[model samples]
Target: SCCPGWSATARSQLTATSASQVQAILLPQPP
Candidate 1:
């Protein structure tokens, strides 16, 4: 029973979180 707005919001959040995780993984660690 999910509406379009809720579905889009969930997808946006998911993508944002995934992109952030990938960026964190690829960034160099500071010594």
Candidate 2:
């Protein structure tokens, strides 16, 4: 495969960012 490591690294980073964003939205919001 061509550029296998780069693609996987990018996907991992994207997933991590998405998870963090979701967590932030789900957390309680202050008044």
lDDT of 2 at 30: 84
- Candidate 2 total steric clashes: 0
Computed on alpha carbons, the lDDT of every model, listed in order, comes to 0.87, 0.89
Return the TM-score for candidate 2, rounded to 2 decimals: 0.73
**Candidate 2's residue-wise lDDT over 1-31, tens digit each?**
6887998999999999998899789985586
**In every candidate, how many clashes are there?**
0, 0
Lowest summed lDDT window (length 10), candidate 1? 1-10
Candidate 1 local accuracy as lDDT? 0.87
lDDT score of residue 7 within candidate 2: 88
User: What's the CA error at residue 22 for candidate 1, in Å?
Assistant: 0.1
Off-target runs (Cα >4 Å) in candidate 2 are 28-31
**TM-scores of the models, in the order given:** 0.74, 0.73
The residue pairs that clash in candidate 1, if any, are none
